[model samples]
Target: MTYRVFSRATVLGTAALLMLGHLPQAHADNAEDLITRGRYIADASDCSACHTVKGGRPFAGGMAFKLPTGSIYSSNITPDPAHGIGGWSEAEFSRAVREGTRQNGASLYPAMPFPSYARMSDSDIHALYAYFMKGVQPVAEAPPASDIPWPLSMRWPMSLWRAAFAPSVPSAQKDVTRPFPDPAIARGAYLVEGPGHCGACHSPRGVALQEKALSGSGGPLFLSGGAPIDGFVPTSLRQDQRTGLASWSEDDIVAFLSTGRNRKGEAFGGMTDAISHGTQHLSQEDLHAMARYLLSLDPGHPTATAWHYDPAAAAALQRGDTTAQGAKLYVDHCAACHRTDGRGYAPAFPPLAGNPVVMSDKPDSLVHVVQSGAALPGMAKAPSAFVMPAYGRMLSTQQIADVVTFIRGAWGNNASPVDAATVAGLEKSAPRPVLQDKPAPLN
Candidate 1:
């Protein structure tokens, strides 16, 4: 038989037809891929942080959110037909995730972070649904009902809030796309804005109490930071040299995520939970991607005076001076772990000199740590776990303020001085758990 010659267009057309003929199989393969991706997305989102109770089955729910008005327990999300979302269709799940509406037409509190989830792509949502439905084990346990009081408990107002604050999701058929200069940056943006929901804590809030910026580009406030969570202020993720991550390299961010501690300091408070559950499990590539994206953000605001080593404070500290209450306090209480030089034992007590945590403008994280103390989240990669002893009972408000001021100002940290009134207000807002006579052993 004589071979028939074909034009390039004709050959391409035939190849397209062949691909279309295998569309069903391709679609099935895509579904599997989506399920796999969904698992990663779920981990990145730290769904377990809110949905799963401590020592409980994953995604079975029961975690209680202690809000301003009252406590709200997370709903069971396992694929149990009776107690979970097993019966939910993809549409229903998407609505709940993106619109903050329950299958029963009830409004979900902003605590769910659906406003950020609204930015999620349809493919990602589909993937998440597939993962939840097919991959997760089913549990029949029902979540406890919310304990929010009268008017606040009502769901109707949330609809109004949703309408006012929530970003609109494109139709499922329409693809939502964000253009980034690099593919890695785009991936990082997705993780931060969609699933990670970093802005829910890092971004400032508007008058209506909604997050001021949903995504990094929404404004300077996006990750410029000033938001408060559980009495701790989430520090700025911006590139500001003094208050933000300007000094951190991409590796520093990756190290912190992987081990919950970097050269700068260890994560505490809400960040501990995020690292222990969410980011620690992420692939090195993903962590790097997130770091790359974060590094690209503009600095929130440049400080008038850059931080430099304080010779005067060093001299005073060296002189055995008990004149400044702060210096005396540091010597008596902090010197053992933090050391007289402020260079704490790495991978343990974290350094104070040039540390971002110490230099942050808000001082909330520092105050919270001093007042409540914190148990470092256990991570597989970390060498050991430690607990900071709570000083709320031992230290007077002025003493706490004084010590905080000393650290912030003494070690090349140029943040504003903290006052006793500020310390007292935080103490009242969020009281620490009672400390036992004997300290718990660091594992």
Candidate 2:
């Protein structure tokens, strides 16, 4: 009887040991999955756009931000024990990301976009922490210090700004129990409002330069239209007939996000960075969801007439009519690439006719493009690069204005005329053309 009892006890002990071994493996797998999710979140948030320096290590943080006040540099976020967030706990990291507060209690500049990140879910925060801690390569590089001036540069004032403009932490946290009217819309909302932070560029700003609309529900200004970034205006995401995406179907948006081009135009300037780093890697489902949410916005305008081809202008141009200086300028300077009809070579030279950039009320983009020229973002799908040569040296201010005016007014694009003064102003402020760099890897 004693021998039999000893054998049973040994078997039970072995089974318990086996279960204990399996538990650790299960936990490790779960942890890996969380890290994977966190990687996705980081991509969606476009953390690399600011954090990573061009031609430098990813997330090692030497990117320069030229604000109206002064230039500031991004911070290193690698898991390096000395330089990165290797020493940070999950709570410290979360506070830094969500509350814009560093572990040492210094306030972060709004350029970090913690205002939008504050809305992220706790689960996502945990997952992000896991990815940063475990999956990322540790880099021991420190970024350059910011160049912001005193009084304004003081971090304490930002705390007061946060108290007034930023949302409370408890309210912003995502609740799984909360039901969205549609799952796609819910996902899109999460992306745009939190990770995507579309409003950071697209939405109009108040006196304090705070985004007037944080989300779609905030007001019509949410993605309706706003200021220009790096010379390219963020066109209205709303459904306006002229300046917005009313003519574009949901598929068009998805296509644009994925490949950086559709019937309208290709991505250039700041948008190129966004597409290259953030949107291109997103799944088709997420792209569609984003399209759906953007389409749902009420732009406070009824759909009017769709822009169509007018043969009259084309015929007149063919006849060599120099009656309109703008028309004369276009035929002389622009027609070869843009074509006589303003319908440019597709997926290469973008068409100006019926294009949102041409139709925008503000001529900043058109003026800047004409002055400084532009290089379309090179993509894997579209391997060949296309460049719009700078006319700043060749063309006079009035001539530049005239050519843009012709494009804007031609082919049923009834945007307001751009004057030489506007062109002059843009020429003074426009960024100098730089040698185009190869597209950076999304990883």
**Best model number under TM-score:** 2
Quote the RMSD, in angstroms, for model 1. Answer: 5.7
lDDT scores for all predictions? Answer: 0.83, 0.82
Clashing pairs for model 2 are: none
My TM-score estimates for the predictions, one after another, are: 0.87, 0.92
Residues 197-257, candidate 2, lDDT per residue (tens digit)? 8888888888887888777667788887778777778888888877888888998898888
Displacement of the residue 99 alpha carbon in candidate 1, Å = 1.7
lDDT, candidate 1, 193-300, per-residue tens = 778888888888988889887877676788877577887888889887767788889999999998889887888888888987799889999999999989988887
Model 1 clashing residue pairs (backbone): none
Off by over 4 Å in 2: 1-8, 23-25, 174-180, 300-309, 434-443
State each candidate's clash count.
0, 0
